[model samples]
Target: MTTPKTNRKSGFPAVHLLEEIAQLLAEGPRTSNELVAITGYTKVTCCTRLKQLEASGQAYRVVAQASVTWYAGRKPAADTAAIIPRQPTVRDYPVIGRRDMLVQAFFGAPRECRA
Candidate 1:
């Protein structure tokens, strides 16, 4: 009878990869591409591990424009606060009257407005 295959060598490689990724993240925040390059893992694998880290609260992601950066540890309250989109102010939108005046000035009044 053969003994069950139980040994450190038989352990899941993914777990080791997770530890490596966690160690890297502990040093500082990094993007998925950076992780892929450092760990020699495919982008899909790196992103999968990152998602697992996030789900476990061992890491978090910060998305800015076109890139996403991953950081170690549970996400900070300050980070979430910063991520909350601010309410739009009146200045954010140009008044309809002002826009119409500017358009008319630039392109002349519509034919309907001609005498």
Candidate 2:
């Protein structure tokens, strides 16, 4: 069988696909299915991209449960993906008030409001 097209030095998918996947992973860890959903790519394509990411060291995978796995970069280990500082999820912020202000101070009020 032919090998998947991937960068030998970087192990990343071609530029366009890498950007797509990178956007998704930028939020946090994701499963292969999630990548497929977000990128509108086929299962095979998602799997291929993920494999390339792992090979390139841009992403890593770890077992979440029996027969299930997740992928992430920027963490200590893709296999052991965890927030090093244990921060809050985006949804944790309140509507308005002290809690909201704190969340804004901590995470900077989501991606849109900042810029």
Candidate 3:
């Protein structure tokens, strides 16, 4: 009914997101920050895409630490369905979830641990 969507600004082929994510994980598992550092996408965007790759069976989570997680991916099926993110990852909260990522990343020790 409608054409497939790509990223908002870069206008790069959208599947490139899926494929690139998979290729990176081919080597081994990596956290969202690792993927963000390598890909230069915001942590938000990188994380959102990784989840998509996972949903499509092209990627999977490997581990977690603090508020971040590691993931591994594989080349996607030719017939795999693709769905664009609900919103561009440029927003702030979902980078790692609004619950406590800021505290976990910045504060490190929990309030209980600090006092």
Summarize candidate 3's per-residue lDDT along 63-115 as a digit string, tens digits. Answer: 44575554554434323535443567686654532447777788674543345
Candidate 2 lDDT tens digits, 47-95: 8877777777777777756543545563365446553566666666456
What is residue 44's positional error in candidate 1, in angstroms?
0.6
Q: Is candidate 2 or candidate 3 better by lDDT?
A: 3
lDDT of 2: 0.66
Q: What is the C-alpha lDDT of each candidate?
A: 0.81, 0.66, 0.67
TM-score each candidate: 0.56, 0.47, 0.46
Task: State candidate 3's TM-score.
Answer: 0.46
Ranking by lDDT: 1, 3, 2
What candidate 1 gets wrong by more than 4 Å, as runs, is: 1-13, 78-115
